[model samples]
Target: MARTATAAAAPRAPGFLRAALLLLLLVAACRQAAEENVVTELRCQCLETMKGIHPRYIQSVKVTSPGPHCDRTEVIATLKNGQKVCLNPESPLVKKILDKLLNNEKWN
Candidate 1:
């Protein structure tokens, strides 16, 4: 009777572990999707905010990964004047400041 009980329990252990692992994987995927959406949104907003600037001074806008995780995406702007600015999406204040610097009407 003891040997039969152990055999049944052994099969159940693997099933429970697999279910837990699958749940964890699903949660991770959802989190990654959300992070990607946030990055896309931030990129679009940066572009719109900088559109008023002179086209001649704006060379390119690109998304760069600052780290392993996609949570900290840097929006890099290259200027015709040989200047580059990296904007961090993690900080609202920094974004506001960068917007003013890059899109100011007085900036050449």
Candidate 2:
């Protein structure tokens, strides 16, 4: 009876401590995610702000949402110099532009 009680007591203390540590880690991750995203309202659509760029200087492209009422899947072109531009991917002209940039082909 004494040995059984000692073993049970030892495991329970460590088990509770591990659970507490895991809970703390999960809370920290949630807080960090919430802080990283701050949304604002935009009066205009995303495509209205599109600009032209030379394919040679573009490094990569990705999708991001800037605000509500604007297109959610708006494409962001990242230049080699760390500058970024918003683009409307649904347009035929923009598609041609991205294809030219990604394929490393001359834009005619």
Candidate 3:
């Protein structure tokens, strides 16, 4: 009886740890997905805003949303010349334009 009880408790300990790890992984994945969504939305907005002025200037786009101290969003555009331009979503100029282009009801 003592041995059987110890065996049952051993299995339960690993099962509980596995469950906790799975939950932590799931939370991390959800946070990453949310950040990616925000970046995608911002990139689309930037592309649309730049379309008229630059036409085909933007060759590629990369977005980074760093943690607390850094800005919430950073968008890097690769130009035809292999040069890159970084745009901070927190910047005044970027915020103004994005607000006009993305959040405005007129664009819809």
Candidate 3 TM-score to native:
0.36
lDDT tens readout by residue for model 1, 3-92: 999999999999999999999999999999989866644433333233233445656656666454444556666778877665555556
TM-score of each: 0.41, 0.43, 0.36
Each model's lDDT comes to 0.62, 0.71, 0.59
lDDT of 2 at 74: 73
Off by over 4 Å in 2: 1-48, 64-71, 90-92, 101-108
lDDT of 2 by residue, 3-107 (tens): 999988998998999999999999998997787677433443354546556666777877555456554667777889998777767767678887776787875
Give the higher-lDDT candidate: 2 or 3: 2
Each model's backbone clash number: 0, 0, 0
Model 3 per-residue lDDT at 36: 85
> lDDT value for candidate 1?
0.62
Which residue pairs in candidate 2 have backbone atoms (N, alpha carbon, C) closer than 3 angstroms, thus clashing?
none
What lDDT score is found at residue 84 in candidate 2? 78
- Give me the candidate number with maximum TM-score: 2
